[model samples]
Target: MTATYAEHSARKRRPLFRRRSAIPGFAVTMGVTITILSLIVLIPLTAVALKAAQQSSSEFLNAAFNERALMAYRLSFGAAFIAATINGVFGLLTAWALVRYEFPLKSLVNGLIDLPFALPTAVAGIALATLYAPNGWIGALVAPAKVAYTPLGVVVALTFIGLPFVVRTLEPVMRDLAADVEEAAASLGASRFDVIARVILPALGPAWLTGFALAFARAVGEYGSVIFIAGNMPYKSEIAPLLIIIELEQYDYAGAATIAVVMLVVSFAMLFVINAVQAWARRLSA
Candidate 1:
């Protein structure tokens, strides 16, 4: 019943992950993480539902479906979706350009993609407002530039804020897809369009959608940036979050909660759909 020196050394040299049982440390770590997330995120979300439930169904419906609330929801969701869609198409191209081909200033272009992340939202809002204003630089170059106090301004603000999400999401995916599959497609006499449509587009679809979803979600919740550009006019250009703030300022806590709950429900539904798509995509890839 004596173990050989080599056998003993081999046992000692085994990787930490190669143990007979999974690490108790991992379970403890995961438990703590899940608990913290629930407390920080899920608990507050539950509180919103509970508070909204305090009102009768009719009251909640009235608050959420009012003229001002309706306008805000339309503008906010509409602008966010538009911005995210634009970002999705252009971000995919940017990701591909950066990953698939090398050109001058590639590193600089990559760094610029993260500029939105580094820039504060309020500052970005102000800067965009100034640039797109009637008399401002970019505005002057293009025709009339009433962009500062318009719904178009809101879309621009959201797009500016959301661009980084799409770019960052697609970048790594593009990097992984480059060269090998492309070369294989090329060697098989596939045209550029054929390779992209067949071998590349399908692969990029899920990640692209995930990025679009992220950008849309970020845009929908945006307050700081959109407020400056959106003009915050009631029944006109105001967004849902801004409208919620208005209700809160007017001491209409129930009203605010009602609108918040609506935003919460819709946002959850959209993000859930996106997540399901992402999961389906991962399954397809696997």
Candidate 2:
């Protein structure tokens, strides 16, 4: 009877809202995360928006859509998109080779994949310019066609920096894929191309899209590496970030803010679309 009374008392003591979690301090952790994000990301973005808002609508439009600014936007977004696309294809191939094959100096090759990440952007720009300049070794091979100090150079620099994003994002996904799945598909009379297209690619679609988005985002804001190679020619190879710096230098804070707001909006829109595609891919794979 005492034991039965103790059980009843214990049940009564339990709170209605009490629920256990695998990780403790959920409320505290969430609060900390929100605070950090606000400090690091949201607040700065808000400040930019506020600064842009200070401008009259016509002034903002004039600053953002001026002929030179439009050209810069074209160069920036166009080069970034092209570079990311190239990386998407070649990066997948590179990741596949690293995961599935054995080759000479395999460890060294794997390590070298991360070189871009560690190399400073300015250093990378200088190195690329040296190698691709008309007088340089590789540049001599393509002497007739200008590479360095052209928009092509901007694309090359962006591609170099963005490659690692796609490769790194896809590597773990490829590593975890089961060889048996491919073999089984073969046994069912699937051709090699078909197997890759139908089985492997579908499974990797979400991750591939994620990598592409990351590469695009990184390339969009790239400045340090591109300036050395791009020649900074207005309405030609000039990129948006350089234009922003030029505005800042000229003490056109409102103009700079307007350009920044445009970039932010476009980048956010592209990311949103990519995320939607990733979600669709996930659903299809599942």
Candidate 3:
């Protein structure tokens, strides 16, 4: 009877999580995390909301949806989407190469992958502009096509900044993939294309989507890297973040906040959709 009672007490004492975690003080850690996030993220967003509330509905609509603002939105989101898509494809290839078969100076190439992350946006923009400008080296090669000081320049800048996100995100997943599964598939007469398309792609789909989403999000708010190459023509290559800066410079605080709020809402919706897709992919894989 005593043993039965002891067993019941021990069972009740067991942690809800079956495995013991290396980290301790879950409640304290959770509280700290919430506090930090509130101070850093939630508080600023709340401030933006409060500032935007100062504007009347008509004023907000006029500021956010004016012809110039609309054009800026189109350019910004369009360039970001295009850049992220480019990154998704090339980044996957880069990650695969880094993981599978390394060549000469492979370590140098790996280090270079993170160059954009360490380089200042302004510096990167200037370098890209210099390299792609009509009179510049690479620019001379594609001179008639016209890259710098155009929407194409904006796309190039965005692609430069966004590439690392996709490459880094996919690298670990590629490294962890089981080689035996690939070998087994090949031994069963699966073509290389079939192995990549039917076996490898499905496994990496969620991570690829996550990387694409992150790249898109990062590109959407990019300012410094874009301005130098974009030329910032109001109705043409002007981006939304540049528009916000213009509003701020003109002391149109409410207008800036409204634009920011709109961007926040749209970005949130996009990220939410991406997250839903990722969740669906995870379920399918499982």
Kindly list the per-residue Cα lDDT of model 1 for residues 48-121, writing each as its tens digit: 88887889889988999978788899999999999999998888888878877889999999899999889888
Over the stretch 1-286, how does candidate 2's per-residue lDDT look in tens digits?
9999999999999887878877759789899999999999999999999998999989999999999999999999999999999999999999999999999999998888899899999999999999999999888999899999999999999999999999999999999998999999999999999999999999899999999999999999999899999999999999999999999999999899899999999999999999999999999999
Q: What is the alpha-carbon lDDT for the whole of candidate 1? A: 0.87
Question: Which regions of candidate 3 are displaced past 4 Å?
Answer: 2-24
TM-score of each: 0.88, 0.93, 0.94
Off by over 4 Å in 1: 1-26
- Which candidate should be chosen as best, given TM-score against the real structure? 3
> How high is the lDDT of residue 125 in model 2?
96
Q: Mind sharing the TM-score for model 3? A: 0.94
Query: How high is the CA lDDT of each candidate model?
Result: 0.87, 0.95, 0.95
- How should the candidates be ordered by TM-score, best one leading? 3, 2, 1
